[model samples]
Target: MWLPLLVKRLNQVDMQKKGLQLTAEEIYDINNASLKDAIVQFGGFCTGEFISKEGLLLTNHHCGYDAIAARSTPQADYLTNGFWAASRDKELSNPGLFVDILVRMEDVTGKVLEGINAQTPEAERAKLVSERMKALAAEAKGPENYVTYVRDFFAGNEFYLFVYERYNDVRLVGTPPNAIGKFGGDTDNWMWPRQTGDFSMFRVYADANNKPAAYSPNNKPYQPKKHLPINIGGVEEGDFSMVFGFPGRTQRFMTSEGLKLAVETSNPARVKLRGKRLEILKADMDKSDAVRLKYASEYASVSNYWKYFQGQNAGVKRMKTVEGKVENEAKYNQWASADANRKAMYGNVLADINKGYADQKEYTLSQVYLGEAALAPAAAKFALNFVPLQKALKENKADDIKKATDAIKEASKEYFEGFNVPTDEKLFAAMYQMYYNDVPKSQHPDIFKTVETKYKGNWNKFAAEAYKKTFLTSPEKLNAFLAKPSLKTLENDLIFKTVNSVYNNYLTNINPKLQAARSSMDKATRLYIAGLREMQSDKVFYPDANSTLRLSYGSVKDYEPRDGVHYSYYTTAQGILEKEDPKDEEFIVPQKLIDLIKAKDFGRYADKNGELPVNFITDNDITGGNSGSPVINGRGELIGLAFDGNWEAMSGDLVYDKDYKRCINVDARYVLFVIDKFAGAGHLVNEMTLVTTPSPNASTASTSAEAAKADVLENVKPAVDSKTKVKIKKEERKAKAKMKK
Candidate 1:
C-alpha cells in the first residue's frame, strides 16, 4: 500500500489505479485554480465545498447547527422544523462565520532548516525556526488581503507555507430538522449503518466585483473558480472515493507507553467527567424548551466527543493497540542496538517516552479533571473574564475601567441567555465531588481546602452558597455591579476567588512540571520519528494532519468488523423506518418524512432499486475537522459529504486502522431530495450544476486498478435478515481472500 502524500497532490499512478482521471496539476494548479479552490475550511472547524458556480456551499448539518439554533425562536424554530430561504431576501446572515480557501502552497523546508541540524540544542533550534517562520510568513503575505502561515510536517522535519483567501459573507440557505440531520444522535454517532441526512446548505456572498467583503444587502453570490458537479446517480461498492479537507490531527507515531496512558487514564477521565456534565444538561434540556434551545449546541459539542472517547477506549482495548506498539518498538530497538551510531541516536527514545508519561500521569489526570470540573460551572468560567476589570480598578485607571465595564456589560447578555444557575449549581457540586474523588488529595487546589473546612465537605451546600453569593450568577445581579464597576466588589466575590485559587494553583504548581515532562516527550518523539523515517527511507511518509488541506484516496469496500457480523457499504431510507421509535428522541422520524417514504416520492434522486440512499462508507482517512468534507468520485464529482466515521475505529486519531476505519457520508442524492422535495427549495437546486448519474458499468475497483485509472464506489446492500447476514459474512471472507492474492 502506498503512503498518502503530505501535500494535497497525489501520486498519479496510484490515483489512476483508484480511478482518478485528473492530473496532479489539475487537482492543485497554483497558476490556474482548480479543484482545491472549491474546498474551504468551513468556519475554522469543519470542511465545506462550493457546489455551484454561484458559490452555493454544502457542509454537514451539525456544522451550521449552532447558527440555526441561535437564529431560532419558539414561534419559528428553524432547528426543530427546518429552515429554507424562499428567496435571497429571506436568507439569514451569519456573523463571524467565514470560509477559508487555500490559495497556494510552497515547500519552505530549506529556508526553515537554515541554521539547525542534529546537533543544535532543541531550544535554540526552536528559536531559530520561529524567527525564520515569521519572516517567511510576513514576506509571503505581502500587501495582499490573503491569510498566510507556515506549518511543520513530519514532526517538524519539514515545513511548508500556505496562503488562503477568506470569504466572510456566508449565509444560511437551507437545512433539514434535527430529526433528519441528527437522526440517531449520540446513540448512533460513531456507529455505522447510518441513516442520517447530516447535510445543510449555505451560500457565499461577495461584493459586486466578486471579491470577499463584509455582509451587505448589495452583496451578490460570489462566482467560484470551480465548483463540484453533483452526481445524483449514486455509488457502488468497490468504487473509487477521495476525501479532500482539513483532517484535524492523527498521532500515528505515538509510542507504546503513550498509547497505554491515553487508553487507561486520559480517555477514561474525559468520558467520565463529560458523562456527568451531559447528564445534568440533558435532565434540564428535557424539562424545558427554552433550556433545550439554550444548551443544544453546547450539549452536542460536548457529547460528540464524549461518545468518541468511550468508543476510543473500547476500540483501543479490543484491538490491543498498545501491545502492537510494544511489538513495533521491540523491532525498532533491535535495529537500533545493532549499530553504535543508531544506538546513540535512537536508543533512548523509548525510555524517554516511558519516563515522560510516568512522570506526568497524575498531572495529566488532574489537568483533565480541573478543566472539566472547575470550568463546568458556566458562571465560574464567565467570572474570570472580569480579571482585567480587577486590574484596572486596583490601579485606578478610569479609562481601562470604563472599557472593561462596557465589554462585560455587552457580553453578559449572550452569557446569561444560555445560562441556568440551578442547572450549573447541580453540575458544580457533582463534578467537584467526582474530581475530588478521582484526583489525589495533594493535587487539590486551595478551594478544595475551603470546601472541607468551611462546608464540612458538604459539596452541595458549598456549591449552593457559591452560586448564591456570586453576582455573576445572574445578569440582573451582574448588571447592577457593572453600573458601579469597582475592584473591591469583584475581589470580595466568592466565584472570582474560587476561579482564581484553582487557576493560579494549576498555573503555579502543576503546569511547570507537566510542561517539563511533555517537553522531554516532544523531543524524544521527534527524534524517534526522524530515526524511523531514515530506517525506512524508501517508504512514503505522509505528515500527521495539522488542520491543513490534504487529499486522501481509497476504494469503497465493505469490511467484516468481527466474525459473523458484516456491514455493507451503504444504507437506505428504509433503515430509518426500521430504526424509528416514537418514544425515543434519537430515532423519532418526522411524519412528513414517513409520508414521503410511503409515497415513494424520491423522483430522479432515487437509486435504480427505487430507494433513497442515506449514508455510505469509505476507507479514506479522516478525523474531527474533516466533517462536512466533500466525498468526490473518480471524475471529481460530488457524490456525498463526509460526516462521521464508524465506531470500530474510534482510536483512528492515534492509530490508523485501515480495515475498520470507514468514512461515513450522506449520499448526494439524499441531499438533493431533501432540498427539492422536503424543503420545496428547487431554486437552491437550480443553482447547482447537476450531472447525469453514471452508467452502471462505468467503473469498479478491479477494472480501475487493472486499467491504471479511479476515485470511489456505489453498491446496493442486501437487507440484514438472518440469511442475508450469513451471505454477507461469506462474501467478506471471499473479499479478504482476493485481497491477499
Candidate 2:
C-alpha cells in the first residue's frame, strides 16, 4: 500500500521487515540530500527522476508525448522518427515545460485547525482553512524560487505543507520512435504481459547557481542534489520493489452512493462522449501525418481516460466494490452503536453521506452531460477566453482591454496549434446532439431553444453556420477582430453566445444544489474517517493520494488473474516479435528493432536466459499521476519506470485490491537498450551511472544468473564526464558560428 513520505519514519520497522534497505532519513530528509531530491513532478502532471548529476531525467513516453508532439512537424516528425540530441547544443527546448523537486514537507494540521471547532459551520471552516493556508504559504515563500502550498489530507481532517523548487528550462534528450515507445497503443495500454518500451528522456537546465530560472540559451544543465544509480542487474520473481512519485488522486473514502453515481451515471456519459470524439479525430488523423501530429496529444489525452472509465465501471461491477463499501458502513455503524460517545459522534455519518449523494443524483447526469457534451467543442471553449476582453471592451477600459487581449493572443497560439476546423465542427454537431438526446428537457441550456427555432433542431446545420460566421475558428480571423476591438461583434457571435448561455445556466441553476450536497458529504466523510481511525488505532492509516509525493512498496511477482490463467512476472523481446502485425498499427514493429531481436543482439543488458527484458509487474499501489514514477530496488537504484496499471484493477483508485492491482513498468534495461542500440544515443547512456551488482539481500538468484553477472559487469561502461562534454559542445557551437560569419 502507498504511504506518505511525511510519516514514513513512523513505519520504519514494518518497511525494513518488507526488505527496505534504506533508512527513513535516506528516503526523505529536509536537511540532507535524499531520494526525494532526485524525484520531480514532471510538467505538473507526471513524475520523473534525475539519472545523472547533469540533470538528465527519465519518464514514460506517454508522459512526454505532448512535449515531443509539440516539437514535431511534417519534415522533422519526432513522433514517428524519434528524436536524439547528438550534442548538448542540439537539444530542443520545451517552452512551458517545468519540473518541481520537493525541498521538504511539513505537517501543519494544528496550525490550520487553530481556530476551528466541531460547531463551526462548513462554509466558515472552509474560509478559515483557506486563509490560514494562504498565510502559511506566504510565510514559507523564499527568494530562491521555492513554491509552497498546503493541501488537506484525510478529507480535510489533517493538512500538510509542501515546498518545491521548480525548474523551467527542461529539454528533450532522447525518445524511441512510437513504433517502439507506443508499440501496443490503446489496445494494450492497461494490459499486462506487455513489451512496450515506454520511456523518454529529458534534461533540466538552470542558472549558474543551480537555481530555478526561465528558459535561456546560456543556462547550464542543472546539478541535482542526488541522482539514482542505474542497476542493470535484472529483476527476479519476488524481488522487493518500491515506486516513489506524486500519485494524483484516489477516492478510497468514497461512499457506496458515490461509487454508484460514478458507475451508473457519470462514467457512462463521459465514455460515450469521448468515444465519439476519438472516432472523429482518428478518421481525420489517418488521412494525413500533419493532422495526426496536430491531434496526437489531444487524442492520447482523451483516449487514455476514455478506456479507463470503461474499465473502471466493469471492474467496479466485477469486484462488487459498491456492495463492499455498504457492508463496511454497516460494520462501522454497529461499532459506533456500542459506545454512547461514538454513537453521538458518528450515528448519522452514513445516513448523511447517503442522503447527500441522493440529493445530488438528480443533477449528476445533467452536470456530466454539460461538461462532456456542451463544453466539449474546441471552438466553444476557445470562445470563453474572450469573456474578459468582452467585459473590458464594454467598460472601455484600455488597460484591461490590452491585458486581456494579450492573454487571448497567447492562448490562441496553443489552441490553434492542435486545432482542426473540420474535426471541431463535427464535434460541435455530435456533442450537442448527444446533449439534446440525453440531458433532461428542463435542464437544457437556452441555446437548445435557438437550435430548435432557428435551425429546426438540425445540429449539423447550426454547427456549419456557426463555424462559418465565428472568428474563433481561425487565428487570422480572431487576430483581425482583436485589432479593431468591437464589443458589439463579440456580443452577437453565435459560438460565444452559445457557450455563455450554457455556462450561465449551469451557474444559475445546477451549481448551488451540487455545492450544498458536496458540503454535507464532505463533513460526514471527514467525521467518519476520524471515527474509523480512532476505532482502529492499531491499523496504519495512509491518506488517499492528492497529487502529493507518496511511496508504495511491494515485490516482483506474477499473478493468477483468473483460475488456471497464471501470468508471469516479466516479458522480453520475444513477446514483441510474437505480437507484431504489420497490418495493425498498434502491433507494428519497426524493421530495425525486429531484426535486432531476431539476431538475438542481446548484450549485457539481457537476463540469464539471454533475453532482453522489457516490462514487468509489481503489486505497487499506484494510480493516474503515478505514471513515469521510478521503480527502485531495495538498494535505492533505478530499475524501471512505472507507466500503466493492469486492467483487472482499474477500480484501484476507489478500492485497492491487493491481489489484482499490479503496476506495469518498462524495465530499465529495456530503456537503456532502446537508447544505446536502437536510437544510437550512446552519449545519453554514458551520462548515467550503471551498476551491475545485485543487492546482498536479493534471495532468488540462480547459479546461472550469478555466472552471468560477471559478464554483465564486464560489458558495463562508466559514465562519461557530462560537464566536460557540455562545455566542449558550447565551444564548438561558438566556433561554427564564427566560421559562418
Top candidate, metric TM-score: 2
What is the per-residue lDDT of model 2 for residues 679-716, given as tens digits with 9 covering 90 to 100?
A: 88898999899999764434435556544553443343
Cα RMSD (angstroms) for every candidate in the order listed: 4.1, 10.5
Per-model tally of clashing residue pairs:
17, 0
Please, what is the whole-model Cα lDDT of each candidate in the order they appear? Answer: 0.84, 0.87
* Best candidate according to lDDT: 2
- Per residue, candidate 1 scores C-alpha lDDT tens digits across 449-469 of 988898898889988888888
Q: How close is candidate 2 to the true structure, as a TM-score?
A: 0.94
- Model 2 worst lDDT window (10 residues): 718-727
Pairs of colliding residues, candidate 2: none
Looking at candidate 1, the ten consecutive residues that score lowest on lDDT are: 707-716
Q: What's each prediction's TM-score? A: 0.93, 0.94
